[model samples]
Target chain A: MDLIVIIDYGMGNLRSVEKALEKASRQVMVSHNQGDVRAADAIVLPGVGAFGDAMVRLKRLGLDAAIKEEVTAGKPFLGICLGLALLFEESDEHGVHEGLGLLPGRVELLPTNLKIPHIGWNRVSVQKESRLFDGVPNGSFFYFVHSYAVVPKIDSDVLCRTEYGCEFASGVERDNIAAVQFHPEKSSSLGLRMLENFVS
Target chain B: MLSKRIIPCLDVRNGRVVKGIRFLDIRDAGDPVEMASAYDHEGADELVFLDITASHERRQTVVELARRCAEELFIPFTIGGGMRDESDIRKVLKAGADKIAINSAALENPGVIGRCSKRFGAQCIVVAIDAKLVQAEPEKKWEAFVHGGRIATGCDAVQWAIEAAGRGAGEILLTSMDTDGTKQGYDIDLTRAVTTAVNVPVIASGGAGNLDHLVEVVKKANADAVLAASIFHYGTYSIAQAKEHMAAAGIPMRLTK
Candidate 1:
């Protein structure tokens, strides 16, 4: 399949995600329909705003289970920002809300010392090899603006880490599923390169 | 490890990018799409296009410009100015603008922020506050200005910032009309006042003449980002140069790979 489906349930920033994926020379289609996503070569779930709100929308559109199935089929799956956080067990941003449970982790608020909503570009250091970051240079910075993070229960779930007052997972990959806390679309050249790697 | 964001603010008038001194020079810069594409390539973290135009010309030009830039720009870009209603905001967002910033319109309709935040996620909505330090009221509080900084709104700047946050604004873009174009530095008191009052990320705009001014605002005001125009447009400094200075000063920027 030549199409790269960007699952949009009305909560995520879809246009920038589409433009970035297209910049990677991938034919992208932003859709909420599971059937369309199932037909695509790969899938991307880009999110912004509150975790509770995002989960509510995903469930409302019945995309949560669809996404799980898509990843289970062994196609490349990528989550961004809140999309990454929503791949965990639950989040406490506004209240306790269940996540997709695709990975073993819990989304919690970033520590208070380093400022709430870590806004701006942050560097990512690879922790291991993964197709998601294949050609991306080491120590590349990706744009991040979030209030919560995923705390992986198992260390192998972590793919890359970055420090902001405290070190945290910036990128995570397991099998066909990979997610990043930063916005590669908005992260500039290094970010575009990562998108290129993911699509290629 | 957050990198310092270098944002270039484009003041659009009659479908053209323009810059001025205290909003007076009003000279054309170039095509908004071309300029934006250049910034996107030159390492700008994000871009802001303020529709400084006065008529319906904004609709045709801004939309066309946004669509053109979105075709090439891979980073997030915000569009502001002359956005008076939900339809206006919708038009831009549909045209590929990542975020919509409302200033005068938001002040006129207090519910605008809540409405926009609800319709489009809060992260896609930015509330811009243009404040001027009045000499002093009997209450000794600086008042904010609206209507293109032509009229004094008599409201406290900090109070308005808090109200905007309470209304579900995702971020605050505060511009010091008093210090704008002065090239002295940002109004630290004003920047600190609003940022401390609101939990959202505050972009310190206006009066950024040099790299030191940017560092001072980040350090003293606790601002999440800094924005400028003339220095970047005139090529006095590049985004890389400014970030290098900030990095050297121990401001904690994301290092380039």
Candidate 2:
């Protein structure tokens, strides 16, 4: 049950996630192979690139099907940053592109008029009780580096909200699948604790 | 609210941490990895490792250093100093550094900024500018410098920042050489000038003697972050202490409590 596979679709910061996961879990593997992903007890998909490019690579590697299958089978799954956005139905990043559709949402530009990329540390204020934030305090700060955010159609899916110029869903949890737009692996102590919670 | 960042920059030479005063008089602080870990634990939002000895031969050392830091530290860290092109940037990104700050290289070929930004997403490309005030007829203007601040590029600092932003730099690390190491305060006019010109986040570097400097740069100059070395290296102020001071001064910080 300790096996945690961080899906590497030939893009993003996979090593940092793997290194961070190693601290929280006994066994962590960053693999592009669908077989390793399917065999894992839990899945962590970490991303940091464009929406359309990531989806293309995932499908090319045949990981898209594997990820959908594993998560549908009730395996605990987590997505970080772009990985969070990828779970949605579609994205309007450079142009309209389809997503995994695992979650009912659309990835759109942060409605904020302030800045393009909401880069820096921001508070993730909790909305609902979820195991993802078990020991972490409400409004704990996490490192964020993205311009777009997911707008989950289902209100209850959001676990936390972060303020830039406008509030956006920063963290979401739907049953066994939980994801965060912020990089937990890049966040400090409290972030590690949240990762530890997910693995445990 | 997205809290203003406090970043501790480590100027490394041959892989050891050193704080440089006015781009000279380098003093050894400690091992880069150990200091980086301590800063990460102390609540630093991010860390920047600049290899002062940024020769092509020594690039491998920094790459190795990046690999070690990624294995040890959790908070996002940036590797800078002497990255000439996309390949150099790609090597460090592969090794583990979250961002690549290009100063001299970007100045040598301004096109490198857009090229690197395009190849490796703008999120990971940071443009570091060493700016010094040049006395002119109409008014004083800050000009961008290169070759470790020894050579001048005649490029107006504020104008260059605007151009860099247009070219796709994720963040601008603006350092005022005049106020650097003086510790009196940050260059408010210079920082404000560039921050106003650039849409991207600007990190005010060089002059941070006390905690109030951090707040001044943020409030008066509109700096998105403040990068310090000597003060934090000598333990003049810890990250938590800086956060407390900033939070008390009405500047939002990443304080869990």
- Could you say which candidate leads in DockQ? 2
Give the per-residue lDDT digits (tens) of candidate 1, residues A1-200. 37899988876447777878887764889898978877889888887777888888988888887888888779888898887998899888777999899888898888658666676677789999877777677787777777788899989989999888888888799888889998888777778788888888
Best by lDDT: 2
lDDT of 1 by residue, B63-178 (tens): 77677767778778998877788888888888888888988888889798898888876777899899988766444355778887888887888899899888988889999998
- Which window of ten consecutive residues has the lowest lDDT sum in model 1 chain A? A111-120
TM-score, model 2 to reference: 0.95
RMSD value for candidate 2: 3.1
Ten-residue region with minimum lDDT total, candidate 2 chain A: A10-19
- Pairs that collide in candidate 1 are A121-B3, B3-B254
Instruction: Name the top TM-score candidate.
Output: 2
- TM for candidate 1 is 0.87
